[model samples]
Target: MIFVVTPKIPHFLHFTYGSRPSFSSIHSKNSATSLASTLKSISSSPSLISHGQQLHCFILKSGLNFDVFIQNSLINMYSKTGMFSCARSIFESSPTLDCASFNIIISGYLKNGRLGDAYKLFEKMPLRDCISYTTMIIGFAQNECYEDALALFREMRLLGVVPNEVTMQSVLPAYARADGTRINAMLLHGLVAKLGLDMNVVAWNVMLNGYVKGGLVDLARDLFDEIPGKSTYSWSTMIGGYLQVGRLVEALALYCEMRRTDSRPNEVMLIHIVSTCAQATRLLEGRQCHALALKMGMNFHDFMQATLIHLYAACQQVELAYLLFQEGTKDDIPCWNALIAGLMRNGIVNEAARLFSIMPQRNVLSWSSMISGYAQNGKHRLAIEVFHEMVGKGFKPDETTMVSVFSAISGLCALKEGRWAHQFIRCNSIPINDKLSTAIIGMYAKCGSIDSALEVFDQIRDKARIVNPWNAIIYGLAMHGKAEASLRIFADLQSRKIKPDSITLYGILSACCHAGLVEEGKSHFRSMTAEYGLEPNHKHYRCMVDLLGRAGRLNEAEELVQNMPMEADAVTWSTLLAACKMYENIDVGERAARNLARVEPSYGPGRIALSNLYADAGRWNDAFLVRRAMHNENLARSLDCGVSRLCNALDLT
Candidate 1:
């Protein structure tokens, strides 16, 4: 006989036992017994709450409301339906209560997250059982009060309450969360084996998960392999462990092994595989995983879709990424950001901008991606434009955004914009970290504000001033001809025990070149390999050549070029050629010109330098020959403006 509750009258009781039992027919002991039996049956099913309610009304009408069994059943029903207030009312109004009564109400409170109330009522209980302790232990773990949960489990043990598999499941996660609790978890594992609970699949999965979250991937893998029959969750947990420690290859191998087994990968496992593919940049494997996802009918999951988008983008497969984005729901901001960032990465700035314009909504990530994309592509003006648009639309830029905007300003040499960015950083009280400080220093230096650059450098705390910012400051001072100050800063950097990198030595060499400190330049250049153990690259060699050649020591410069450990690239030879042009040394100039032309015949700057060298030395025929060669090679048009300026300066025309 089916029993149902009518929603038209919430308080009224109706029964469909064989035939509908009317209110008039429900006034007997047998009828009341039947009604109470139906309520007990329906109470466990939360969907039958209305029917349970109607049964409760009938129980009251039959004078069974004061019955302990019926009232506890009602409490259980209300708690299961998430109607905690009604459950509490029944518990408080009960005249006769048992340990079952306390356990029911306490479990309700625990399930409802009323931990304080659960603890209070637990304290007031006259009798406690293993179920009582287990409920509270699980409650504490569920609420993330790991310490309290462990403390209570110890207390339960002290009271001689033997823990079952459920108890181990609850307490194991607590151990995972607390620090220095791995030993306790291991001890619990031993206890579980001793208690013959190790065969319980749920208990084993919990132990494996505990080890994973505790960052013990090796132990987790060991435990995982020991499991006689692993579940999908077991595979997922171990895979996540490997990913956490950057063991992407192992993660993928395990995932592939899982696929070989009968265990079907769920949405979570697919997401992890996709993420592993992204991190490893394995496009082929990622595509196979995508195909598997489609085959398994798990592509509808929003998170999995987002992860796949990121995976394709990371592989530099922008078209595939955009196709995925269009195929999925576009409302997810992360998916949008991933596509935009991917487009920017492939240098498709216009497409990225177009996508950014039509996004349904914009977040900090959206704006930051566009700004960074524009800046990275050398569209500094567009980058600044997006920054302003972001601000005018009331989006507060984050530290990353500020850094990109400052970089754009530095590129454009827009002092006004640079000053505004600095002010914005100051007004917002943004913490000046190394990256931002370096950007600020570079911006001020490029904008011809050496004092502001120095001020920014001075404001950096000693501990926060790393090598990069020091390089910026030294390079800035040297570029503006503050050679002595630049060298002083380098000395300060050394005294502070900050090690100089290749770029730092390059800045010092540049300072020496500008100040004509040929001896200092030579000492620092030799020290690059001697004291610092830095193998000087071509840039370092070029700087040295420039320093010596500028001082009219063209012979020494030529010798340095010939004996360089690395091949002197075109730039190094071009530096010597320019120095020759400056001092009108035809011998070294011709040699430099020959090497430059050989290294890069298509490079216009090298040809122009050679032309200028001939013009300066009154070798008109030789100069014309170089010019005609440039014209014959179709290089003159590209360099016409610079060559025109050089001819006008030297009255060659």
Candidate 2:
């Protein structure tokens, strides 16, 4: 509320804030403490830096800038606002500098990401205190020099400077992010307890986050239950951690518990819950969450709206999802992306594309949404086209977008384009993780470059981290008719003690099918339940039926299908019937054709195979009868009509 009394002083005081600086108050300003407090308050906000500079003019007018406290405050204000030269000028002008003077400048440098400069200044300090050590430690930690941060903390402890809650808070993240074997959550918990910081919710929250990031959700949950007077961050962090690690049921339960508590809830917790319900396709719970958000007046938040849309789309309630999107602000790009992603998730790609075309404004995420949607729906040409269009428009593709683009490239089997995409990922310096590795390896394999795929697989420094690349290589080898080589890779996967998932089993079974390795396929199928403890899903059962039927083990294949836990799908019967036609087995062929008819009555291939089997078995009347039935059902179509199916052609010849 300082007012300008003189015309020489800027009129912003009067014109902007409707006040003027009073010279009488300036003349009577005697208390340096009061002036320092005023300076601190004015300079604390980054938005008020202009006002802070104007106040400095008044301080100099009154000759109070000579005060060491006033000098230090000015340095802090300048440094906080990124005016390092101005801050350093004030520090150099101070005739007498205290430890606080160095602390302010050093903290400013650290905050500005000038870690080396902060360290240089720290080394020159004539004397240091706990706050000085804490500032440097926090600086190193924030700058991701985690080891240095922890080392400094140890030195601080050795110097007998007892740690405070802030110190514990600063150092806990370093421990959490450190090598897991070197850390014990209990050791830090005991240290925090010994410091009587158990009630320090921030410290506890940090510890909870540490445990979650370390992949020890059980420990995090134990600490979460022990936390007294939890904050919104506490609930949000725990719920988010639970969701991140795939503990959906528990996360939902915890949200219900949070709602039962007397404490106020934040928008983040509900958003996460709604998003989780979407992922799980729990439409009932998602609707309940929507009702809760409305009750708490949280539904209007942008994230909540987007997540509600995602929830509806995931559950196949696309109409409701689009209705929700239309009911809200269409100007919001994230909600639009969410709706588009939802459509893609529900297999409504054309609707997603239509909405994307008309968006008033689009961010990088919008383009990425279309790219990812097109890739997911097997519209590979559209995916690549949109990607080039986005690039032409000057939007750089992020990792997720590149992954989708690579998938599209793989679908086209464009080796040159795939190589360019791989080079682009490297040139852009995108860190190659498991999913990216899977995508890149798959791209190379599908593009008719198995050698490049193998090179990529071998270059993975830590291949044992996940079975993703291994699965890709195995499946790719199988697809390339290198079934024995694929089996060898599977053997290596098992030798490394890497647990093969259902997809891994699928790849192994596919290798066996491709090579007609009946005994090996049967062994692996048994090991699925006995060794790996993974129950065979429909894909596994289907692959096995194909393997046995291809091997001419018609009786064994039929038995396997008969004993299947679930009803046989059309593809399973088609596989068996095709094998029967190849082997001229009338009994199994007739049974498979009947089952295929029951499952997919409009399918023509099953009838064609049956007629072919009858003709091979010299049953002309039966073959003629099958052809008549197909014609009656309108299954007899023109040869010119092109086939329609997924573009993911797993041609494991």
Best by lDDT: 1
Give me the displacement of residue 638 in model 1, in angstroms. Answer: 4.3
lDDT of 2 by residue, 1-653 (tens): 01111213322223344344454564565667655655565554566577677778988987888888888878876876768889999887788899999998888787777899989999999988888888998888776677898898888878888877778877776776653343455676678788785357777788678767766677778778878889878888888888887788788788888879886678877887888888889998889889999999888788899999999989999899989998998789889999999899878888888999999999889999999898888899989999989989988888788888988998788899889888988887878888888999999999889999999998982544778889999999999999988998888888873579988999999999999999999999999999988999889989998998988999899999989999988889889999999999988877776677667765667667777888999988777776665555456642211111100111101
lDDT (Cα atoms) of all candidates against the true structure: 0.81, 0.80
What CA RMSD would you report for each candidate?
Answer: 13.9, 11.0
Model 1 Cα lDDT, one tens digit per residue, 336-412: 88888888978988888889989999899899999998899999999999999998999988888988999899889
After superposing candidate 2, which stretches have Cα over 4 Å from the reference? 1-223, 226-234, 241-250, 326-331, 344-358, 461-464, 495-498, 631-634, 637-653
Model 1 alpha-carbon drift over 4 Å, by segment = 1-315, 530-533, 564-566, 631-653
Candidate 2 similarity to native, TM-score? 0.65
lDDT of 2 at 416: 92
**Can you give the TM-score per candidate against the true fold?**
0.55, 0.65
